[model samples]
Target: MAFLSFGSKRDKIKKMIEEEKFDEILKMAVKDKKALQALIELLDDSNPGIVGDALLLLSNVLEINPNSTRSHITPELFQKLMALMERKNPYVRENAMLLSYKIIKSFPEVASQHRDWIVEGVRRGLTEGNKDQKGFLLMVIGELGLKELRPMVEELVSVEDKVILPFEGKKWVPLGDIAKEVLEKLS
Candidate 1:
């Protein structure tokens, strides 16, 4: 059956994602590792829009059923995701940060094994100019409860500026306040 051909579903899922068919992609991906693999493969897509669409689809699948979603995220997939945080496309980087946070939060044991990589991402996010990305990374750092990073996050508390945090609605929050909140949770 053509429908059951190897890589056909993954290819179809990839095409659907590129076409912005998120609802269908979500339906196809929720419990299917091949669908998940398609999303992962799209992370390296040259088109940022396609990559963003794939990331958003993965995020939706994770939110729908984190247990099943996390089970499909093997180490190689995890590494690929982590590497996207530094992608040149701001949209891709931001979405990757959000998805990475969800994955780490839902799969702590797996994330723990990638501590150095996470820390590297945090370090880059903090040092970078994108406040929105910084905000997302702060959430991950807080969830991680890395005491060693307290000082790094603590440094942001004195800055009297707001960042567009991707929370309920990409709310503008004081960077210092968000950092303070993360520090409080860490302590």
Candidate 2:
């Protein structure tokens, strides 16, 4: 009984993912607040690989069952995600932003209710120098489809920091130009 209460199942989920047992992982996570909490806790693990895998699984689970997943998506969770998006690790930050976007996209009603929080989160994610994350933020902004982001989008209009992003294999493109393209799409 003590083992059952104190044991971790994250390793199992990771293993299942390794074995391509997505159905099993989904069965373990979907509509299960406890499992969701466990997955969230896994995000804090020191291993970036573990954290990335957990984020991917969580995103998949939430996408499949947003209505049920909503119970676990509180204001605190969103705030924590905002912080995660600023992580030094680009891979982790990318996964975090992707998961955050999935949550907001799946539940537009929640974003509508918490417009201020979501907008602030978006602003906070738009840091300079992180070309990849800034691009991810742009994609999230597009997914959000919120006109309230106009001010934040305008803030990028004058940014001259050039971040070379890979395109078509060998072609590296500047982020400043991409920002202009995204701004045009927003308009």
Candidate 3:
């Protein structure tokens, strides 16, 4: 009953992406906007492979030009991404978490306005996230210089293996390094 063939749809989308047609891709991504909604809907497909492909496509497009993506990333999109952080698929969750970091880094002012949400997400990741996720989260926290989060960092420091020791092997890298940097700047 459909006029456009499935292969044609696939080829068209792939060609748009390969051509770096970001605006086209974005327009399709928005619901009820264009044929691209099919691709966006695939993001929640029951098939893991389909979902993975959609997430990768979305992430790639956003990363291609974060500033351009900012306008399209409405509050609704943020909430959707935040919810995806708890997805059963680790890959999906990890990508969603990383995307959150990218968004924050790209727009610090907007992120600052949602500081509490960001902090909560980081806290959850640090507490229950797998090692890879924790390491990335630690790096983000360090970069963000959230001194007020020292108490949480301190608790992590209390754990033996969680400490990232200097590669020179001469001294252990204090978890406080991040908090210290933040406090110093504030003082």
Arrange candidates, best TM-score first: 1, 2, 3
Per-candidate TM equals: 0.83, 0.72, 0.57
- Candidates 1 and 3, the one with greater lDDT: 1
lDDT of 1 by residue, 36-86 (tens): 777777877788888878888889889997876766677677667657766
Lowest lDDT block of 10, candidate 1: 1-10
lDDT against true structure, model 3:
0.57
Q: What is the per-residue lDDT of model 3 for residues 1-187, given as tens digits with 9 covering 90 to 100?
A: 8575543255455556456665766655543223344445555556555555556666665566565455555555666666666577766766666666667677777767666776787788777865445545565566566666656665554434443321232134444453344345434
Segments of candidate 2 deviating more than 4 angstroms? 1-23, 127-129, 146-148, 155-185
Off by over 4 Å in 3: 1-42, 158-187
Pairs of residues at least 3 apart in sequence or in different chains that clash in candidate 1 = none
RMSD of each: 2.6, 4.2, 7.0
Please report the candidate that would top lDDT against the real structure. 1
- Residue 63, candidate 2: C-alpha displacement in angstroms: 2.8
Q: Candidate 2 — worst ten consecutive residues by lDDT sum?
A: 164-173
**Tens digit of per-residue lDDT, candidate 2, span 1-187:** 3445556666666667567776777777985666767788778788777787778788888878877688777788788777776677766776787788778778878877777877776676675526565666665676666567767667765666555322232125455555566677777
The TM-score between candidate 2 and the true structure equals 0.72
Better candidate by lDDT, 2 or 3:
2
